[model samples]
Target: SVEGSTGLIASLFNGIKVTQSTMSEVMALIDSSNTKLEYSSQELSNASKKLSESSNLQAVSLEETAAAIEEIASTIKQSSANAQKMTTHAQSVTKANEVGKNLAHQTVKSMDELSNEVNSILEAITVIDQIAFQTNILSLNAAVEAATAGEAGKGFAVVAAEVRNLATRSADAAKEIKAIVESATQKANMSKEVTDKMLQGYNALDDNINQTIGLIEEVANATKEQQNAIVQINDTVNSLDKATQENASLASNISVMAQNTQELVEQLKNAVSNTTYNELSKKRICDPALIFTANKLKSDHIVFKDNNFNNCGIGKNFTVKTHNECDLGKWINAHKNEKFAQTQAWNELLKVHEDVHAKVQKTVDLYAVGASNEEIFTYTKDVEQSATKVFALLDKLREINCENKS
Candidate 1:
């Protein structure tokens, strides 16, 4: 029994090397996990930062789009109203045209009546012309008979001559009146043709106005549909924006948890060391779930108390208690100076981005060449500067869009 107890003690005492070896493996595993967590957290933070920038840009673009749509809708409404007025005026003109057509018809009728009266006058002139010819012949026969009767026939001859002369003058006067009446009738016929053409022109004009009115009504209907579609798009963007903010928050939380887990693993590695590892099984167990943590994400609230932005004017002034969305033209007009400034700042900021990329590449190369942590720290300032520039651009964008606060 004593020999068996001594043997058991020897076996237990010799197991320390095996125990230390197993603990070394555990420490290696913990080191690997910590490395993964650090890399992932850094990547997450970078992505979240970019996403925040994208979300803000989307907000600015969406607000601009919405303001543009509202202005378009207003313009359409005004144009539609003007078209309605034009339609009313066209109807009035059509009525007046009809009245003019009636007057033209009356003029044509009067001309026809005048032409008929002229024809009657021409007929009377023809009768007088024939009578004058007969009278002249009869006068010639009486003159010859008077010459045969000498002195007794002289008085009869003079009387017959005077009668012939009076007939000739009557025929001449009738011929002149016939020529004048024929010319007047021809002019009246031309006048009727002109009046008829005027009536046709009026009818064509009325038709054109009716077609124009129909087109205006169609445009008004289309504008209404576009307004509805834009509203739907705005609602969708807002919902997506909220979801994006939630994901960013979750990423931040994961980063904190990873840092804590790395610290715990460090302690656990020390506990397994041969220097003081006799308390082996007394250590508190870690939850396996910590190795694969995932977080539930949430959105950022819009109406937070510190929701203030700098004024660079694209919409109404943020400081104003009440303001309406501005038109595209007005928004552009408001942001001209700011836009110019942004462009200049962006050029400088772009260099910062390039500089950061070069610095990071150099830092990686230095690490490979056995650079110390203190050496790596020197390059960190360049990264921080890049971050600062990005934030500055973001803040500038915020100020530009603040004027359009919903």
Candidate 2:
């Protein structure tokens, strides 16, 4: 029978080894799976980080493009300003040329009047020459007539010659005046022609000025358009920059989540490694000897009063509450099954609880039956004292079980 007992004990140990090996394998598998999950989370985080970086770069590029657009708009504005100034200058030149043309026209009219006056003076000189010639001829005839009168006739002839020379000089002066007037008229006509050409040139310049104004207006409009476009670009770039910043923030959060996941995986692996169960044979109380020991002190008699000992016609009160009826039913069912009925520790613990209940119930019954408070207290104290011994024994048994598990 000792040999059979030893064989049973050996079999129980073997079962324990098998259970431990199985638990270890499960823990290792959980660790590996956790590691894989953590690695996948980290990969996702890295991808997010890269996407954030790309977004940041795109934001920078957008900003640069916005700045470039702004620069082009500024240049357009400057060109427009220059065009406006040029248009103003062209208009001033055209006005000045118009004033010059007016002055030239007036000068031509004055020159024509001067030429007419010169012609009138020439006519007057011709009339005077004819009168002088007639007078000179009359003087010569008188001189001839007087010749018969000696020296007096000779003096008259000299006077007629001097008068004739004076008339000749007057005629020469009139001819010079006529020639000067003719030259003046030609110059005035040339001046008028030149003024007309200048006026035409001024007209052309005016046309150019108008064209320049139109061009400048076009440039101004273009500049305004460019400015508006640049403003839009700036706004877009700012939005992109903000989005990139948000993306970066999101990436940071994702990275933190990945790291936390890795840590959680490690914690899960450790938790799995720490959890284990004893062999099935050792987990229960199944021996006939243990059953006999537990049944020795069992009683069905119920006490009317509640106490720390004996049956109180009530179910056992657990210190900790279960979640629901399902959990309670499962625990109760498991206990009723008593699959490990040979477990000595379990039998002994149940016996101790039964003994304490019986003692406490007896005290409560005494108190209910008009016993003094001091007597009830003394009886309860003795019952508690016995319960303490039982607790010590249970603690030692648990320690032995822990040592065996280790």
Candidate 3:
């Protein structure tokens, strides 16, 4: 009984030591994990903040674009309306020109009729002149015969001479009327020529007006089509703006959640730290190298060196250089005075880098669930690719800065 009792006591003591050691390591690991979680949350918060800011900028751009589209649409509509008005005016002018040509033709016809009437009047005047002349000649002959019968024929001769004088005056009056009629006929013929020319001019004007109307109508139709297309584009832009707004709201929510996660991780770190208060005297500064170990069981993110990124985390027989992770803290501190941080496109790229980091962080959980080695490799490759994109984006921002200075 003494021997058995002694054996049982020793086994119990050994089991307690093992449990204490396991708990101690668990506490340390939890503290380290808490650090990584805090960093991840802050990174997520920053990324969400950037994403929200980008969304705001995009919304503003969309609003301005929509306004510009509205202005253009207004201008286009005005132009189309003016075109329509011009078309109406052109049609009216064409109709009026047609009327004018008809009037001109009628005027030419009237002028011709007037000329015919004038010619008839001239012919009547000529006939009058001939009759008057014949009358004068007959009266003169009578007067001569009366003179030959003298004394007894004296009164007859006087009457015959008076008749001859009257005929002579009448013939002179007829000639004067005939001369006036000839002048009237000449003027009427000239008027007919001018009226004919006016008719031709009116006809030509009508044809030109018709052609102008056709061209204006075509322009109006084309302008209408352009306006319709622009309206559709405006609608699409509005939809995009709405989507961007929704995205901004989502980013804001993510930022809040990140902040909450950081708080929770801090609490967990404190609770674990409290469990090992007696161990603080022996505690060394946190093993920063341990944070970069390729083992996801200990760390959550890929460790990218200062300048080189191709060899992410670590490989077999690989040694780690003592450097900060991603240089993000330095990058962020330097960004305070850097104009690139304020750039919309640059901030967007930053968000993209953070999003990729988030996806890569998910691999830690996957590894805990016994994910396949191939699956892990695939995720790691994606992280590298995303890191390359981030570097390229930074280069682009530098390019923009250089160009601006130049």
Query: Candidate 2, after superposition: displacement of residue 176 in Å?
Result: 1.7
Every candidate's lDDT: 0.54, 0.57, 0.67
List, residue by residue over 40-135, the lDDT tens digit for candidate 3: 999999999999999999999999999999999999999999999999898888888888888888888888888888878878877877887888
Off by over 4 Å in 3: 1-36, 271-406
- Model 2 poorest ten-residue lDDT run: 296-305
Cα lDDT over the full model 3: 0.67
Please state the error at residue 361 of candidate 1 in Å: 68
**Cα deviation of 241, candidate 2, in Å:** 2.0
lDDT of 1 at 251: 53
TM-score of 3: 0.58
Name the regions of candidate 1 deviating beyond 4 angstroms.
1-40, 131-162, 203-210, 220-406
Candidate maximizing lDDT: 3
When 1 and 3 are scored with lDDT, the better candidate is 3
Clashes of each: 1, 14, 0
The list of candidate 2 runs beyond 4 A from truth reads 1-40, 111-152, 269-406
